[model samples]
Target: MQPTFQNIQEAAQRIAPLIHRTPVLSSESVNHISGAQLFFKCENFQKAGAFKMRGAANAVLSLSDEEAARGVATHSSGNHGQALAKAAQSRGIKAYIVMPETAPSVKKKAVAGYGAEIIMCKPTLQAREDTLAEVVKRTGAEFIHPYNDERVICGQGTAAMELIEDTTALDIVMAPVGGGGLLSGTAITTHAMLPQAQVIAGEPQGADDAYRSLQAGKILPSESPNTIADGLLTSLGTKTFPIIQELVSEIITVSDEEIMAALRLIWERMKIIIEPSCAVPLAAVLQQKEKFAGKKIGIILTGGNVDLEALLSKF
Candidate 1:
């Protein structure tokens, strides 16, 4: 089922008590550098340390008593797994998260901390899916896809809805496209609430399937995605791809170096700790300053679930 504006609204009300109404912030230095007014919806501060919580809460809450009793399951690299775990804990239900072995230790620890059983698999997407399938078949858990499900998409839309409500006169709403869940939600909400605003997505150059898919007019699988933005390594899902294709105006690709620079800028100047995935949108803005010059842009800072020990050691 396609998620609509009303679904997003209902999701907002449904998950209201379950998640934080994260603050919208701006950095003057960032604005000056980008030559645009950048308003960041800081989902990094959200419960579970990511905006995925909004969708996870909605999906879990929307379940019937019988369905909830069966529990929920999904395959995730990090944020979504932690989100589903947190949401399931809130509802006092079981959650089985199938995670890639390559996912950051911090994210895996967070998922486990939320009381979900983590099943580790090979780093390949195929392995993650196969593991999840086996777990679901054995456990009778309802598979709540990380990005492709209608409930999850509607739940994701709430973040952008709140962003539009708390801010004024946004010319564009931007998010980093991983499986396209957040971007799809952002597009649906922006088109509904602020029809004049364009919805754009930022993707890592190394993981440019979303960009390639848009150009090819189809959903393309992501293979050998090599980037620091671990959260964005997945390809666009079936449900998310259609919504993004219809509503998103563009998909911008930025290199790893640019993403790192943007990440550092946000940390040094804005004093916010963001993971590399969260910096992709800002990297896009900085990479193409002329396109966004003098515009009011709203960027969703997706998550802050960085492996600090591993990251800091490089510096």
Candidate 2:
């Protein structure tokens, strides 16, 4: 089913009790540095340490008793795996999470700590898909795709809804686009609640499939993306592309250097630790400060599951 504003409302109701209503924050230092009034939706403080919990909770709850008993499965390199695990555990059901063997050890441990069975696969998307298929077959588990499912999209939309609810007159709403799930949902929700607000997507130049797909008018898979923003490496899915095409106004691309700069700025100014992917949107705005000067720009702080010790060691 195609996701809509109504579906997003339903998802909000379903997940209200299940997930945190993450705060929308701003920093005077960041505002001065960027020349834009930025309201950050801090999903790092969310359950499972990411916004994925909202989608995972809604998807798991939407299943039937029989389906719930059969359990749930998904493939994720990080936050989403932990999210699905938390959701399944909440219901006393099993969650099978497929992760690329190259995935960060911190994320792997997080998923396991949530009580999900971890299945390791090769780093490729094909490898994850193939392995997930086998696991689903073996366990009869209902597959809850990380971002492509309608229920998941609906749940994701609620984040934008909350942002809009908290601050009613946003000039622009932005988020990092990977599979296009969060951005597409944000587009739909922003258009629904505040039609005047423009929805933009931030994309890493190293993983620029979303920008290419938007330009080509078709989905273009990224075979190999080399970037620090690991969460934004996935290709846009069929389900998410159409919604993004319909609702999103534009996509802005940023280099890895720009992303890192934005990451450091936010960490220092806002006193928050967000991942590289989460910094993409802020980076896009900072690079285009002239365009966004004094505008109320709302950006999604997508996740915060970083290898902090290693990251801090670099600088």
Candidate 3:
């Protein structure tokens, strides 16, 4: 069944004990920098070190024992892979993660630490899907898409549910869009809880497919997404795109340099480590501070999964 508000609510209740109710942080310095009263939902501190844990837990837990016995499988190079591995571990089920060979070794280690099997593939999306299919065929495991499935979407929405519940009177709420799961889930939850709040999405200019998709009234895949935000490279999913098209008020694009600036600013001002993907919304807001000035806004810090040593090379 396609996820609805009730599904999101149910997902929250189901995963409450399984996942962390990560803190909503704030910084007067960051607020001053962006010219907005910013509430940062620190999902970087979540179980499995990303908000993906919420959705992954819900999906795994929602499966019946018979189905779970067959386990679950998905293709993700970063946080989703780790989240699914952790979720499967909690449920005592096998998880097969199809990762690109080029994916960071740290992420692979994290997924392995959760006891999920790793299946490497070529870096292309097609290669990842093909590899995942073979894993499912051999294991008879249920396929759990990283961002496209309804259960996953509903699970992702819980972060926004927490954000809106924790912070009052938010004028706007924005999340970074990759496959649109988090952004769409956020829009669904935010609109349902705070109808007055505007929902925005941030996209990397290198992978501005979501913005183009919204304008075109259709899902448009990015031919090649080249950005430092490795997590935000995939185009929107079939299930998630419609929700984003209908609910998102604006899709803002930010450059890699702008994302880097935001990344440094947050680390310096808030003393929190966030990945480039997590910094997209803040970068978009800061890029157009005049539009967001004086507004009470919420930004979802999606994850902190990154190679700090490699990241430092950029500076």
Candidate 4:
């Protein structure tokens, strides 16, 4: 069955002790600059350095005993791979991760450090999937998708639950959109609990599939994304696209420069490090300040798995 609020709640209960309840921070400086009352859900501090842990742990733990023994396999760019590797290790299950050849070395080392086997592939989604398929077929491992599963979505929804619980009556909640796992789950949970809360998604301008898809009223595939927000390069998944289309109030786009600026702002003002992908929502707010002025807004700082050297060189 598709993930619902009930399913997400159950997942939250199941994974509560395993994951951090990460703090919700407020910044008057950010509010003053953007003219919006901002509540930041600091998922960059989450375990595995991203919100991916919620779903990865849920998917790993939900597996049948037989499936667990067979182990788990998946494809990810970085954060999800590390999350799955760590979650699988916690359950004493071996994990096989397929990552792009061009994925950040820092992330690749983290996944390997978690004791998961790594298989490198070309930078295409198709290549990653094919490699994962072969690995799963060879080892008879359970396939744990990075985003396209009900259990994964349910796990991701918990982030939204915690955000709303921490602060009440938000005018809107914004999350970065990649495969749509986080946004889809946020939509389900937020709509069920805070029906008045509008859930918006932020996408990079260079990889604006989610924004274009929402605007066109159909699934729009990204064509060779060239964005610096490496984590937001993927198109929406089949399961997540329909849910996002139904539940998200809007999908906004932010340029790569704007994303970098937002990233720098978070680091300088909040004293927190966030990757470009994680800064998309904050970038949106900065770019469209008038629309969010004087309103209570919640933004998810999705992850912090940036390569410091690359970031430094860029600036």
**Model number with the top lDDT:** 1
Alpha carbon lDDT at 78, candidate 2:
92
Q: Which ten residues in a row have the lowest lDDT in candidate 1?
A: 306-315
State the lDDT at 189 in candidate 1.
94
Model 4 C-alpha lDDT per residue in residues 1-315, reported as the tens digit of each score: 568899999999999877999999987787898889999999989999999999999999999999999999999989999999999999999999999999899999999999999999999878998998899989999998888899899999999999999997898988999999999999999999889989988899899998998889888899988898999888888999989989999988999999889888889889988888988998999999988988899888888888998879999
Instruction: Report the C-alpha lDDT of model 2 over 163-279, residue by residue, as the tens digit.
Output: 999985999999999998788889989999999989998999999999999899999999789888999889998899999998999999999899999999999888998988999
Name the regions of candidate 1 deviating beyond 4 angstroms. Answer: none
Cα lDDT tens digits for candidate 1, 1-315: 788999999999999999999999998989999999999999999999999999899999999999999999999989999999999999999999999887889999999999999999998988988999999999999999999899999999999999999999799999999998899999999999999999999999999999999999998899899998888998999999999899999999999999999999999999989999999999999999999999999999999999998788656
Off by over 4 Å in 2: none
Task: Please report how far candidate 3 places residue 276 from its true position, in Å.
Answer: 0.7
Tell me the spans in candidate 3 whose CA falls farther than 4 Å from its real position.
none
| Alpha-carbon local distance difference test for all models | 0.94, 0.92, 0.93, 0.92
TM-score of 2: 0.98
